[model samples]
Target: MNRRLLVAGLIGIAFAAAAYALMAPAPESTSRPNVAVAVELSPAERGSLVTRRRFAGNLEPAAEFQVAPKVGGQILEVLVDIGDSVARGDIVTRLDDAEFQQSVAQARAELAVAEARLQEAVSAANLATRRLDRIERLEARGVASASELDDASGEAQAQQATVAVTRAQRDQAEAALNSAEVRLGYTRVRADWPGEDETRLVGERMVDAGDTVAANTPLLSIVDIDQLRAVIEVPQSLYGGLAVGDPAQILPPGRPDSEALKARISRISPRFDPESRRTRVELIVDNQDRRLAAGMFVQVGLESRRVEDALIVPRAALVNRQGRQGVFTVAPDADSARFVAVEVALESDDRAALRGVESLDGPVVVLGQDQLTDGAAITRAGQAQRS
Candidate 1:
């Protein structure tokens, strides 16, 4: 009985220990660690936001004209060569006028002959008038027969008719003389342009000396480079916003360091091109220094819109949250940095203009905002402790 009691007491002690182990709680785990995100911050600024629209265009002369000859002949002399400057009424080219001069001389000689014949006709008409008067007087006095008076009258009328015919011939010769003189003047080709200075540059020379060209054949190309035109094709979406006298900036591709040329919208096409769905626009640029030339590719910037004193931030801070676009504004806490999401209104290439978040007065998260949530912890980039 003593041995059995000892064994039962040992078994009871083991069972009690197992029951206590089953009822006991496990030790609590440490709290989750705070999320660390590196961030760059920028201040919200009250500044201006200018919206610019850019387009590619080519420079062209505001006024371009082709010089052609009115009279066909062998080009005797090309007074102006390519790149030469000429003024209005300046002779640019000349044809061989020896033939034309001879024609003029022949016409003058014929005119002189016609004038002499006209004087002779006047004298014969005077004689016929005197004879007719004498015949009338004799017939009235009955000193001449009816047949004699009739013959005298017939002869006088014939002489008058001859005088009239000679007068018409003289008039015809005068017209021929004028026409010949005008033709002779056409041999001297002159440059004609409308301007106070009338000066222009010769862009091309088509014919050389001694080269034969027909009438109305192009001889040279003249352009006024003092003013230039930037021709740009704008898409239909942007065409309606353009108007005459709008300001523009023109930058030459070849000279990037040069200052942008100032221009104004001078023309806009009335119709759009169906194939391109674009409309042509012309900007008048003052090229008084003659730095810009035709056919040079250029970049044009048009001021589309502007907003002054707008709340702006860097574009890098923009983020999309729950289908809404906004920036993460830094909210300072006692020990950590909290990022609050703030929605924005307008955005440009480098900046965004804010609208809804009026309480945002601190720096915005420019970098590392993609891995953030509202009230998320962050540290300024380069300021975090090295582990």
Candidate 2:
């Protein structure tokens, strides 16, 4: 019985050894990794970039002139009121001229009387001179006394003096007449400007008809709307790219979809505001259509810069690696990817301008870079090998 038991134990030990050998872990699989990949992309096509820089500003008339009276008088009539269209030399206001006309007539009469007196004095002076000449000849011939000749000369001198006095009086009278005429002319007030017509848009009436107005009193305000100015204040820290003759755009406020008007930079304030730390720029626009007005809020756009023939890439494709900027480039075999550092220059919209690329023919990964390493095998989207 002991021998039989020994044989069974030996068989059991052999079967256990065979089972352990069969259940042992198979050799480690040496299969390749299946990494998910993003699709490769190319840079966006380049064309004319209408870049714009916007700023809030105010609208104003390019040229504004204040209408006022030149002389002081009682306003008898107001021919033109506020918002009245007037031509050059149009009668805007009138003053009381009855008293002024009477004064002119009196001056004219005084001038006529002075002229008559001057003519009579001249005739008398001529007669006295002839008498003096005859007396001088008679004294030379020893026919007249020397005392008589001296008396005739004295009479001539007196007459000459009288004539001089009358002439002076006539000159004074003429000056008075001119003064009266000028004063009378002040009664008719006309628009004084060089243009063929004065463009009256808005005005303020300070006095009514029959109201007395002082010299240089502001009767009303008139502004020309044919041309307008768009003024904008820019911060000092920003680059000043606007200068005279530069192209600009003026956009009216309260309307987002309205088309912006085109204009040109015409003036720049030499003095900068100390408190606001900004400089003012003015843009001139031809508003012959009268669509723009003064004191309206607007926005100004100045295109001061442009980048041409610049290489641009998607901003999302760039990654930061140990404080260095890098992008994932597809491998030459087209089945893997590698990280390469690049230098960026400018950023606009969602694209970036970068350098350090040998060529643009290589495909670039647009996504899936967080879990990627150098030379990692990847399966691109839509490829037959992709899961």
Maximum-lDDT candidate: 1
lDDT of 2: 0.76
- Candidate 2 lDDT tens digits, 65-87: 56677678899887877667766
The CA root-mean-square deviation of candidate 1, after full C-alpha superposition on the true structure, stands at 7.8
Instruction: Kindly list the per-residue Cα lDDT of model 1 for residues 272-352, writing each as its tens digit.
Output: 999999999999999998788889999998877777767888888788878777777765542234455555666666787
Tell me which residue pairs clash in candidate 1.
Answer: none
Give residue 359's error in model 1 in angstroms.
12
